[model samples]
Target: MTMNAALIRAILRIIGASLVSLVFVTIAVFFITAVLPGDVADALLGQAATPDAVAALRHSLNLDKPVLVRFVIWVNGLLHGDFGVSLISRRPVLAMASERLIHSLLLAGVTALFAVPVALVLGTASAIFRNTLFDRAVSLLTLCVVSVPEFLVATLAVFIFSVQLHLLPSLASISDIHSIGSFLASFSMPVTTLACVIVGQMSRMTRAVMIDALGSSWVEMAVLKGASPAHIILRHVIPNVIAPLFNVIALSLSYLLGGVVIVESVFHYPGIASLMVDSVAARDIPLVQICALIFCAAYLFLTTLADIVALLSSQRRHAA
Candidate 1:
């Protein structure tokens, strides 16, 4: 098959799988929330409320319906972009979820903007330097940062950056990313905390992968042919490892997503992960399901995109 056709086919397959998995994810999120101990009705009514009042409330909320029926209703609503109401808050789920999702997306975006190119450069430098002082220092620094828990890192960052130097705020809560100063003021701590682990891991992994690529026969031949170091590394080394690098980048992005939960809580950032924690604590079933579904969807989307990119890289290698 032609490389283009193969690449296109792989892209479609990955997207199709993502969609199917998202469907199952939604159903699973709903049922798992169903099995949790506390009932939305109970939480809404309170412990002192009458049994009759709770039953009426359950019926009103349609919690009295069979699981299948409720799931069907939810799916229908979801198709129409309605995510039901938060039992604990009585607010629209979609409204709250969308707002928080945007926040999380923004955090992820800023983290990526700072993390990716820096990681690539660090990885390249570490690989080229090997066991030299620069390489050892990079390795030690990354290992130390990676070993630290995000919450601890966040606390230390706040203490040093905010409390000590007063260079950044501890808690990030500004609403406008469009305002440059405000955006930096709000996100500096959380983004630094959130991106650190991912950056560390990616840089180390990329270095390892690129080092192996650079050590290969083809790279050695290119070097013997008097190819420029930059040309050989960029064209011969990186391209050979591009597929694995894509996977590493995708996994790092996923790490950033998962770490958002911890970092958001530490920084009191208003994002989907924070909302998910609150919803779970309150046994807010609708909101919990919404948040979980979103988390699943976002992860699936990232991995699928990674797969597509890797597939294209593979096809290109084959064609070459």
Candidate 2:
């Protein structure tokens, strides 16, 4: 088949697989959440609530329905952009989630905006200076950072920056940001912690890719032709490695959604992951489920987009 047809077919397959994966994600999220300990009604009304009151509250929240039935209802509502009501607050789940999601997006987006470029530059530099002190230092730094958990990173950041240095706030609350300086101080730690994880992963993967590319016969041929290192890398190596680099980037950034949970919890940031933690504690099933699904959907979307880009890039390279 032609390259165009093959690329189209591959993209369609990726999207179809993503949709199927989303269906399973929904099922798993629903069943797992349904079986979580503690009743929503009991949590909302307290342990002292009468059985009749609990039953009435459950019936009102439609929690009294069969698990499968409730799943179907929830899925149907989800199809219509209705995430149902927050059992504790009596607010729409979508509205509550959207507010927190925006915070998360800001955190992750800002993290990516800085992380990607820094990672690419560091990785390329390390690869170019392979076996030198700079390469060893970059490798060691990434390894150490990768070995450390985000919560630890965040905790150390707080202790040093907030407690010892008194340069930044420990908490990343949005309400405290009254000016640009406050905004930076408020967000700096959380963003740094996240960037540490992302940059470590992306840079290591990028370094490996760049090293392999640099060792290729074509790269050697370019070197023998007296091409400048910059021209060879920027014109040839980067073009060839773009697909793999894009995949590394997408995967690293996808970790932001998962890692943000720990960062949010440690920093007391008002993001969806922390909201999910609260919802679980309050037994707000709808809110918890929606938050989980949003994370899953984002992961799938990034991976699917990466697949498409990789396919197109591969096809273009082959055509060239």
Candidate 3:
């Protein structure tokens, strides 16, 4: 196939994969949510409530329907952008989730903005200075950060920044300030916590990719031709490392989306993770299903993008 045709085909494949992934996620979450051992009525009203009240609440919520019928209705609602109501709050789940989703996305963006370049610089420097003290020190620090659990990092950040130094608030609260500053202040802790993890993983991947690229045949030839180290890295090393870096970035993006639940909860940041947790606790089946499907779609899209980039890179290298 022509190069353009090949690229189009690849894009189509990725879209198809993402759709399949969304379907699977919807099915899995539906069954899991359906099987959870709690009645929405019981969750809303205490267990000591009268039997008539429980039965009436169940009927009102359509929990009296067969599981298959309920799942069908839930899926239909999801396709139409309705995420049902929260049993506890009596609010539309999608409406409630929307307010927090923006916060989480902003926090992730801030963390990535700070983390990615720092990781690339540190990783490239360490790779250049491999076996030296600087390399060793960077390696050790990356390992330490990676080994620490996210919650521990969140707690330590709270202790040092919020509790002791008082640089930022312990809990994020929406305020009357300008939107830009208010968002920055509200999400500072969650952003910082996520940045720590992002930096560690990205640094490790970057170091490995750069080290390998720098040691490749083209780099050796550039050095033998009396090219400056800076020129060699900029011209050869960076291009060679782009494919792997793309993969690393995609993986990190997926992690940021799906892996921040604990960190979000620990820091009390009102993000999608927190929403999912609350929905699960209340057995809000529709909310849980929607969140799971959205997350899965995101992950699948990222993975597919990575695959396409890797494919194009490989094709270019082969043509060269």
Candidate 4:
């Protein structure tokens, strides 16, 4: 097949796989939430709830229906863009999740803005200076950072920045963000915690790709021909490694969708992850299902986009 046709076929395959994965995620989320302990009625009514009252609430919410039947109904609703009503609050799930989703997106965006550039620069510099003090230091730092769990990093950030230094607030409250300074203060800890991990991962992956690019035969030929390191990197190494770097960045950023759950919980951030935690605690299966599915869909979308980008880049490289 022509390279263009091959690339198009690969992109179509990625899209199809992503759609299948999303459907499986929806089923898994619905079933997993369905099996969790406790009932929404019990959570909402607390000690005041009697058996009869609980039964009536379940019936009203259609919780009395069979699990498979409920799954089918939920899937049908999803196809129509209906997330159903929140079991506890009786509000539309979409209405409740939309704002929280935006908050999560904002957090991810801010983290990306800070992390991506730093990762790229550090990765490139480390690759160029491979095995030197700077590269060794960076490698050690990333290793240590990656070894630590995100929650620990988050806790240490709160302890050091908020508790000890008193520079930033521990809670990332949106209501507290009125001015630019306040906005920075509110986001500083969570953003730092997230960026710490993402930067470590992206930089490591980028460094590996760049090192491989630098070690290529053309790069060696450039060195033999008296090319400067800067010229070799800018003109040869970077272009060759751009596709892999894109994949690394996309994969690393995809973690934010899932990893933000811990960070959001720690900071009491009013984001979709926090909302999902609350819904799960309340046994709000529908809301939990929707939230989980959203995260899965986003993750799949990013990976699929990265695959398409890498495929197109390969075609261009071949044509060149």
Q: Using lDDT as the measure, name the better of candidate 1 and candidate 4.
A: 4
lDDT of the candidates, in the order given: 0.88, 0.92, 0.82, 0.90
10 residues in a row with least lDDT, candidate 2: 1-10
lDDT winner: 2
Superposition error at 163 for model 1 (Å): 3.6
Worst 10 residues of 1 by lDDT: 1-10
The true-structure Cα RMSD of candidate 3 reads 2.2
Candidate 2 error regions (>4 Å): none
Candidate 3, which ten residues in sequence have the lowest lDDT sum?
172-181
Q: Give the per-residue lDDT digits (tens) of candidate 4, residues 75-163.
A: 88988988898877789988888889999999999999999999999999999899999999999999998889999999999999999
Please give, for residues 106-188, the per-residue lDDT of candidate 2 as tens digits: 99988999899999999999999999999999999999999999989999999998999988888898988899998888889
For model 1, the superposed segments whose C-alpha errors exceed 4 Å read 1-7, 176-179
Predicted structure 2, TM vs. truth = 0.97
lDDT of 4: 0.90
Q: Which ten-residue region of model 4 has the weakest summed lDDT?
A: 1-10
Q: In every candidate, how many clashes are there?
A: 0, 0, 0, 0
